[model samples]
Target: MPVITLSSDIGLNDYLVGAIKGQLLTAMPDCAIADISHQLTAFDYQQAAYICGNAFGYFPGDTFHIIIVNFFDQHPKRMLLAEYNSQYIICPDNGILTMITQSKPVDIKAIPIPATAKSLLDATKLIADCIKQMITGKKPDTTEVKDIEEKYPMRSAVGTDWIDSQIIFIDNFENVVLNVTKSEFEEIRAGRSFRIVLMRNSEFITRISDNYAAVQPGENLAFFNAGGYLEIAINKGNVAGLFGLQRYANASNMQNRLLYQTVRILFES
Candidate 1:
């Protein structure tokens, strides 16, 4: 049976998610439907990208991943159908695709939206139709998907003695995930000791723990998460809530924003 995965900002509290699933099943009754998340922050592509990017690789190669967060970002006349790493993704023309993959897709096409379609449900049905066609070995008439016109998530700012990063995601347990990866940290460290400074140097973590059990129940720790990104957490506690760390949109003056906080790693040479 074909597998279809859904990630969306449409919370489960409403009928929209069920409606979409019903539409999908109506088209292909035997297909398996899985959900990545339905509580993604509205219009926050970075968060959606982070979650989908890390989760998509674990599914089978032919999985069809549908992302509906901020589906109207550009009021696009067409939706995007992207084939990357042998998986298929259908989402809006927004930059989330590039943000998630960190590169341009090799095979992408545009699925036209009818001019009369205004409601989100209309678009949802269109997506279902597209999936049905793909499952039957039929290709829709489409144009090449274009490059994103806007900026995506920022890379870590590297300096001689420090790597400046930001909190990309904070999970339900309140553990903080940074934009820096383990390989990036090691490449920059070159065997030098480092300190992870939190909240603009108010506090710091000096060791990379293996897991939550590596530290006492209330102690703070740093480690690479299953996604291979560096994370900060307090064993059996809410690190993000306690430290007041939150994810913010990428802006030119992001540092000056009221809730903005940058996670810095200072390497001792």
Candidate 2:
């Protein structure tokens, strides 16, 4: 059965996702519809890219990914039918395509969705139209590729080095994800010890936790997330919302304008 995977920042509140699946089923009955995520931060392209780029490959070949982040904004209604590593993606021409394409040889085709459709609902119908045609063994009518945009995989943009002790992303747990990779942090350690400070007001946690359980229950501590980024988190608190920490592509409140301020990663090396 053909599969459709959905990724979006749209929370599970409205009937938007349900309506999309209903439309898809209307065209292709018995279609396997899965969810990459519906909890991505709104307009956070970095998080979307990370979630999609990392997980899309895990599914079977030719799975269609519908990404709705920043789609209906003031930007042009440029949909894309992108094929990378045997997977099909339908999304806006926003830099997301550039990031997900990731140097891989992809067939980028423009889609004139808004022209044929009147409103966003119509646009959704158009998207269903494209997917249905593709699933029915027909080549979807897609526009030619235009100019390419630069999509940086990391938050700080491309061509820039990750600074030591730099904060990266904030997770749902309010855990601050630092840009410093395990290898980078290890190099800086060089057998020397280091301490982690939270907001410079709380007690300084001197020990680096190898796992989440390193800290006492309900006690906030620092550690590396599965992606190997350093994370600052309360054992059980809305650290992000509580501390005003922004997650994934959100700018932190720092004077550098280059660095975010929610949780700064300072080192003793």
The candidate that wins on lDDT is: 1
Error of 2 at 237 (Å): 4.3
State the C-alpha lDDT per candidate.
0.85, 0.68
User: Candidate 2: which stretches are off by over 4 Å?
Assistant: 100-105, 153-169, 187-192, 201-207, 241-244, 248-263, 266-269
Pairs with backbone N, CA or C atoms under 3 Å apart (clashes), candidate 2: 174-240, 252-260, 253-261
| lDDT, residue 165, model 1 | 83
Model 2 misses residue 80 by how many Å?
1.3
Write down the lDDT that model 1 would get: 0.85
Clashes of 1: 0
TM-score of each: 0.93, 0.77
Error (Å) of candidate 1 at residue 125 is: 1.2
**Taking the tens digit of each residue's C-alpha lDDT, what string does model 2 give over 1-269?**
89889888777998888888889889889789999888876666766776787678788998888888776665456687778888888877667877766663457887776555555556677788888888888888777785645465553221121133434455555667665566766665565656555545564566678776777777767776666666777776666565565543455544553323533434443
Clashing pairs in 1: none
The residue-by-residue lDDT of candidate 1 on 11-74, one tens digit each, is 8899999999999999999999999999888767777888999999999988999988787766
Residue 92 accuracy (lDDT) in model 2 = 72
